[model samples]
Target: MVGKFTVVDGHVHTFASEEVSGKILTSFNKLYNIEFANPGTGTITDVLQNMDSVGIDFTIMANFAPAKIIHKNNSWSIEVGKKYEKLVPLVSFHPDMEEPMDILMEEYMRNGAKGIKFHPMAQGFDPDDNRLESVYKMSAEAAFPIVFHCGRVSNARLNNYADIDMIVPVIKKYPNIPFVLTHMADGNIGDVFKLADMFENVYFDTSIVITGYPPLLKVNEPSWPDNEVVEYVISKVGADRVIFGSDYPWGSPGHDLNRFMEMRIEDRQKSMILGENAIKIFKIKSSI
Candidate 1:
C-alpha cells in the first residue's frame, strides 16, 4: 500500500517458549512480555500476513535461544523459512560455549541458515574481542554474513560493547567475511561511514534510527538531517553497503514501515534501501 517495490525487513526476533514470561522493552519504553512456553507471535503465518499487509516481499528473520531457554525455539526460525518461501533464517550461537562455531556450522548452518546473528549487548560479548574470532572465522568460511548489535546497552553491560572500533580489527583481519552492523552501530554513523569506505565486506543496516535514536541522529534531518547520515554512509560505502532494517517489533512500536518508506530519498535510492541493495550483497533472491 505504501510503495510498489518489494521490501526486506532485515531484522526481527521470535521468542522460544510461550510459557515462561520474559519482558522485552523497546528503547521507547514499550514492553512486550514474551511467554516462552507458548507459540511464537512471529509464526510463518504471522510473518506472511505482516509482510503482505505492509507490501514487503521478503524478510531475513533472526532469533537467539539459549540452552536454558527453550533452545528448540531456534529451530522454529528455520521452520518459518520452510513454511514461507520468502523468509530467510539467520541463526544465533552462544559465545560462552566451547567451539560452538563447529556446532553452528555442522547443525544449524548445514540445515539451511542463510546468515548468523551476534548480540554483543544482549549476548554478552564484545564484537571485537579475540574470543569471537573463532565465531567470525566460521562465518567467514561458511561464506555467510554476520549481523552484530551495536550501540548503547540499555539491557545489559557488555564488556567493550557497541563500538565499531572493537569489531573493525576483525573486519580488517578477515577481509573476506561480511559484517552487518545493526542499529547503525547505535549512533556510530561516522565510524560506519568510515568502514563502508574501508571494507568491501562490511555493511550497515538502517533500522529504528529515526525513532529509537534521538532527533540528532535521524538520517533525514532538515539541514544535515538524519538522512544526511544515510546519504553520507551510502556515499562512502556505496548503496550496496547499506541494507534496510526495521529493528522491528522493538522499533516498530514507534516507527511504522510507511514512514520508513517516506523518508527523503530518490526513487532509485529508496529502492536500494527497501530491498534491491540487500539482494545484491547477500545474494538473496528478490521477489521483484
Candidate 2:
C-alpha cells in the first residue's frame, strides 16, 4: 500500500500503440515533452508495472471514443481488462453514434461492463443532449457510474460543452447512476465542487488536479493546487464524495494522492479519497 493506504486509480487509459493519438498520450506530450517509445510502456503491461512500483492495487481502464475508432477501442478495453484481473474496463461510445443504446446494452450483456466514460467535446455533442436518454436510463437501472469529461482540454474544439452547468440537469434526472465529474471541471473545479454538495449521486475525481489548468496551467510547469479551494470543497461536499484518480500516463496518481495527503485533514478522510470512495462507488472487489 502507498503509505498505509490501499490505493486505486479510478481514471486511467490504455494505448495499444503510441500512434493511437487519443488524449491519454496526447495530453502527456502537450503537457510534457516526454514521449513513449510506443504503447510498450503505456499499454496494459505498462500500467501493471507502474502499479507494482507505486503500490497501486488496481485501476479502472477508462475509455474515450474518438469518433473513427469507437468499436475497436471499446473492444480493446474489454479485452485488456480480461487479460488482467487488476484492470476494470469501462464501456464507451459516442452519444451521437447510431443505436448507441443498443450497442451499450449488448456490450453489457455480452461482456458485463459495469461502468462507462464519455468525452463530450471529443465526441462533438452537447453534454446534456436528450439523445443520451436511453443509455443513461439503462445505466441508471444497472446502477452503473458514468464518468464524463466535464472540463476542457488542449485538443478539444468546443470548450463550453464540458461545463458543469450544462450537465447539472442531466445529473439531476438520473439519481441512480453515480455521475463522476472528471478533472475537477478542469480548473472550474470550485464550481464543480459546489454541485457535489447539491447531488447525492454526484462525485468528483482528482485526476489532473495537480497539473496545469486553463489560462496558464502547464504539465511542464507544475503548480501546487490551491489548498484553500480543496479544503473548502472538502468542507462543503465532505471527503466521502471525492475519489482519487491519477490520469495515468498523463499525470501521476502518487502525486495526486500526495497532494491530498499533505492537506490538513483527518487520516480517515485521506483514506477515503485515496481508495475507499472509488471502491464504494465502483463496487470494486478486493483484489488481494
Candidate 3:
C-alpha cells in the first residue's frame, strides 16, 4: 500500500517500440504537444521505475494490438506480465482477426489475464461494431471486465469507434460484462456519466484526461480535462467507480497521482479511486 492507500494504477499500456502504430504515436504527440520517439518512452523497466517512485503498488497493464498483430502483442504481454508481480496482465483481442475467440479464451483460461483491453483508436475498430457482440457475450459469461478505449483520439478519425452513442448497445446488451470506459470517453464526459447511471457495471478511469506530463516536466501546456471537469466527474460519478489510471509515457502516473491528490475530494474517496474500486471491480487478489 502507498502509505494510507492501496494504490493501483488501473490503466496502462505496454508495447514494443515496433508495435505502436504511426497513428497511435501521432495521437500521443498531439495530446502532449511533444514530438515523442515512441520507443524513448519507458519500457517495462521504466514502468517499474515510475511505479516505484510514485508508490503505485500495482498496475493493470494492457497490450494494444491491431487485427494483424494481436498474436505478437499478446504473446509479448504475457511474457512481461509473467515477469512482474506488480504488473497485472490485461490481454487484447481483435474482432476481425482469425481465431480471436480462441485467443481470448486461452489468454484468460490459461495465461491468467485479469482483464481485456480494446483500443479502437490505436487498433483501428469501432467500439460499437456488431462483430464485438460475441466477444462481449463471452466476457459477460465469464464476468471478465473489458477496459475499452472510449472517446476519440486527439487528431484521429477512428474516434467514432469509441462514440458514446455507439457504446449503448454493447454495454446494455452485456449486463454482466464490467465495462471500464477509458479516457472518460475521451471528451464525452457527460454521456459517460449517463452510462454509469444506467449500468452498475460501467466504470471510468482517470488517465490522460488532463495532462500527460509528469509534474517535474511541467510542460506548460493546457490540460484537457481540467480541474472543473475532474470535479464534475468525481461529484457526479462518486469515487467508487472512478479508477486511478495514468496513461504512462503518454501520461504520467506520478503526475496523475499528484493531480488527483490535489483535488478537493475526501480522503476516503481518494483511497477508493487509488485502488480499492479497481480491486473490487477487476477481482484483483491483491493483499492491499
Candidate 4:
C-alpha cells in the first residue's frame, strides 16, 4: 500500500508476449510520431514489477486485441488473473465473433473473469449496435462491470465508435452493470459530467487525462487537465465516482501515482480516488 492507501490501478493493459507488446508500441509510435519510453514491454511480469515499484496493490488487466484474436487474448488474460493474486482480469468480447454470447460468457465466468473490457474503436464495432443488446442483457443479468475505452485515440482512423453518444444507450439500458469510462471520456468531459450527474452506476477512471500522456518531451502542448480542472471534476462528480488508472505502458504508474498524490485535494478524496472507489466499483474482495 502507498502510505495508508491500497493503491489499486483501475486500468492497465497486458499482452501475451513481449513481441506483441513491442509491435503495439511500434504502432503507437508511428501514429503519434513520438517514441514512447521503455514501460517494460507490457508483459505480465513487467506489469507486476511496475506495480511493485509503485506500491500498487492491484491492477485490472484491461487488455484488448483484434476481433480475430480476441478470444485467445481474453483466455490468456483470465489465466493470468487466476495465477496472480493481484492481477484482476477484465476480458474483451466482440459481437461479431463466431462464438455465441452465452457460451463465451459461460467460459469466461467459469474461468474466473472478473469483468469485461470493451474498446469499440480498437475492436471496430459500434457501442450502440443492436447486435450488442444480447451482450448487455447478459452482462446486466450477471452484473459484470464493463470498463470501456470511452475516448478517441490519438491519430485514430475513426473516432465515433466509442463516442459518448454511442455508449449512452447501453449505459442507460444496463443500469445494473457498473460502467467505468476510461480517460475521463477523453475529449468529452462535458458529456462525462452530464452522465455522472444522471447515472449513479456510471464511473470515470482518471488515466491519461489525469496525468497527461507519458514522456513529457513528446507532447507538443499540455493537452491534459490542469490541477484546478481535475479538482473541479472530482468536486463536481464527487470523489466516489472518480477512479485512479495509470494506462500503463502508455503512461507510467509511478509518475501518475506521484502526481495524483500531490493533487490539491483532501486525504479523504485522495484515498478514495487512489483505490477505495475502484475496489467498491469493481467488487474486488482482496484485503487492502
On lDDT, who's better, 1 or 2? 2
lDDT (Cα, tens digit) per residue for candidate 4, span 125-152: 9887787677788889888889888766
**Who wins the lDDT comparison?**
4
* Whole-model lDDT per candidate: 0.61, 0.71, 0.73, 0.81
Would you list the clashing residue pairs of candidate 3?
127-161
Q: List where candidate 4 sits over 4 angstroms from the true fold.
A: 32-35, 155-157, 212-222
Clashes of 1: 18
Model 3 per-residue lDDT tens digits across residues 181-272: 87766646667677778999888887766554544134323235467677777889888888888776667777677777787888999899
lDDT of 2 by residue, 68-129 (tens): 67777778888887778788888776665664666656676468565888877656777677
Error of 1 at 137 (Å): 2.4
Which candidate, 1 or 3, would have the higher TM-score against the true structure? 3
Winning model by TM-score: 4
TM-score of 4: 0.93
Ranking by TM-score: 4, 3, 2, 1
The number of clashing residue pairs in each candidate reads: 18, 2, 1, 0
- Each prediction's Cα RMSD? 5.3, 3.9, 3.5, 2.0
Give the C-alpha miss distance for residue 37 in model 4, angstroms. 3.1
